[model samples]
Target: MVNLQVCSFNMVGILFLLSLILPTISGDCTCDANTEEKHNSAALHYKLGAIASILLSSVAGVCLPMLGKKIPALRPENDFFFVIKALAAGVILATGFIHILPDSFADLTSPCLNQNPWGNFPFSGFFAMVSAIATLMVDAYATGYYTRLHFNKQANAGELEGGANENDGHVHVHTHAVHGHAHGAVIPTESMTLPELTRHRIIAQVLELGIVFHSVIIGIDMGASQSVSTIRPLVAALSFHQFFEGIGLGGCISQAKFETKSAAIMATFFSLTTPLGAVIGIGISSTYNENSPTSLIVEGTFNGLASGILIYMALVDLLAADFMNPRLQNNFKLQLWVNAALLLGAGCMSLLAKWA
Candidate 1:
């Protein structure tokens, strides 16, 4: 209960900080005086429709895996689940490399900014590299810290129970027993240890954070745009974008095996972020200048950071971990299929980038 409360508080704090920071970054700027103002009734209707469609698609995408618990074939132990996860990780990987990275490059290299450090230095790539390293640090430190704590707790528990054991050196071995079977095999508890579970939970949360940051920025841009032509294609593309991204995020959240409330919180949070960002963009549309120096710096920096986080999560946490799994490594056919699925997912997401 205390952990739940602490998590809830942390989430609230993050939301609050985002609320405060985005507005400051998105506020009116004096740098760009010749901004285009093309707001119209048609565009307003499109944006409103976009909000609804994106919301529904996001909700459906994220909920699919959660509801898949009822389907026997969709269970985590099944081969199909691995394929799905591969596709999802591919989507995330493409999102980071193909989609967000380019946007960061464009923003950081824009002509609106001063030509001193921004123009001379490849700030986008630098920031992205730094962000990636930072993410690696966070991933390593968090996993190591939690694993140490979990093992220490187990050690303490074992010591407390040491007095009751007949032999100090005799370790307890848990075995899997079948009700109808005469004999059962001893199975190692390492398959789903507590620390492993904790690691999954951490990955899910961090992945969500990265996705949410990017999603909100996308929403704000879409909401602030007044071009009907631009908004029309984006409405569809972004809907698909949110849907696939949600599937990826939902897959992680599902694997985390969070409690009902925690799962709901994660799903709801993911579902709402883009739409809420769109609403925020709409509210600030009149004053927000995308081409301004301040806006460029803020958006570019955030995009770079988000790109790093997603790339790290997809490559290190998701792809490497799953690809190197004993089951996948042992099965050549499954490996080939997963690789194909990954390419397919990456291709699909990359194609969407042409418009979105």
Candidate 2:
């Protein structure tokens, strides 16, 4: 027979394992904030509604602005478009700082991870800084590569002054032409110059990449959650969030003037990402475990990187570009309005953070 001391040690081991696997019966632990309880059915209902609202809002917001071809007021040339861009930039900024960054901090620093290295080192902020630096490197390199592709030595004299009037300038790369060995597919420039159009295209795609990652994570988060109180407020906040993002992306797409197919595909993707993520979360709710250290690490890392990308894009590509534009700067009144619009958008998203 086992001795009393040995039996006691075995029993303690079993209890310790049980504690790790099972939800705390009573305590302040909130790592499993989305665990299903009495509100399972209601939460699922709210989640479905969220899927619909998020899809519709994003689709409408993006499509309406893309209709700039049909509606003069929607075109980028309109002075009011600057205000919209500012508003969207603000939304993107708040999403990075308020909505996502804090969440990363929560996940990485959760009590569940008290024993992990994540608690010892500031992994989230470090990853975020790295992400921002990487984005800048990619942005600069891509622009330079494309710039060289578009300009010839003959046209190099007026490299900045890109136009066919420069003779050999027509020899420059087509937005749809070959760059290196890859599809030199380029943005169709109509009102805006080729360089400007290309920049917008790059910005749109990079921003989309960040959005896609962030969207899927949040979708799973909402899907895995089983709290009606959380899901209910989340729906409205997410809808508005999608709408604002859609508008911003749509404006970029419109400016880029991509092939009709490309534009539609992008719009569809932006609209569906969150809803799909939510569906995935719901499907996995039975098995989803946020308390797992691995899940926390992955989510926190991705959110941190995504927040960095978004913060960089909003500040550098969106707000900084427009704010410093000659037209907005030359007109102080317009600058004021644009600044006000940015504040309004940031304020709205920041306010929504309470519920989201």
Candidate 3:
């Protein structure tokens, strides 16, 4: 509880500082008045098309892993499942490094912002670093808290059993020894423990938060733009972007083993965030200015934070955890295949950055 409170306080402080600096550092930056005044009926049509295409792609991508239970080849126990997860992790990693990070840098370092503060400082890198550290703190504390809770429950159960079996204490002890051995033998091949499952659930939720932050920003920008040519290509690129990202998130959600209702809620939430942002953008398009100092600061800060969370998650939670697993470590052939898949996923996402 103390740690959590400290983390919360730190976040509040950081946000407060950003709010103070953003307005004062407006610099020489001004929105492109010429672009904002332009209107294209064709762009409106493309925006609508983008909404439908992105929504469907997101739904399909996320639902694919949830359906894995019905297909033996896609089940979590299958070797191929690891390969798919690796690909997803790679995509996420590339998105953080290649796509979001650069955007944040561009936003915070724009010439329109004041040179004394915004130009003098690498706020983008600073925010990204701070956010990454914050994510690590959350991940560590949450895992430790859950693990401690699980063990405490087990200890309480043992106490109850001890009180009930005074007469058969020795026999119970002997039986427990054998039981423990049996449980230990199956640990390597069996599904995740309760604590491990809880950790995965936390990871999936946090990962979604990071992804949604960037998705909404991108969607809004796409919606607000008046160029049919720009919206047309972005519609396809972002569709593919959301699809692959959904697959990555879906794999984690599937492994978390959420109930049907919970899974549906999460999946629906992920699928709708982008489209919802676009809709909101459409409503505000006439007045919204992406290049405004306020817009740049808000979007840039959030993007930096999201990039950090994603980079940490992809590198530490996803890649390191899987690569270091005994099963992967012991099998050279599987490791090679997984590496290839990782590269392929990263390459594909990087290519999408060209347009998206």
Better of 1 and 3 by TM-score: 1
TM-score of 2: 0.83
lDDT of 3 by residue, 89-202 (tens): 888999999999999999888765667788898888888899889888877787778667655644655676776766666555446545643432111115777557756777
* Residue 66 of model 1, lDDT score: 74
What lDDT tens digits, residue by residue, belong to model 1 across residues 9-95?
665564455445555654344554445557567888999999999999999888877766687665566788788878888888999
Candidate 1: residue 332 Cα off by (Å): 2.4
| Best candidate (score: TM-score) | 1
What RMSD does model 3 have?
6.3
- Model 2 score (lDDT): 0.77
- Which residue pairs does candidate 3 place in steric collision? 27-113, 27-114, 29-112
Clashing pairs in 2: 175-185, 175-186, 176-186, 177-184
What's the residue-level lDDT of 272 in candidate 1? 85
Per-residue lDDT for 191 in model 2?
A: 71
> 336 in model 3: Cα distance from truth in Å?
1.9
lDDT of each: 0.76, 0.77, 0.76
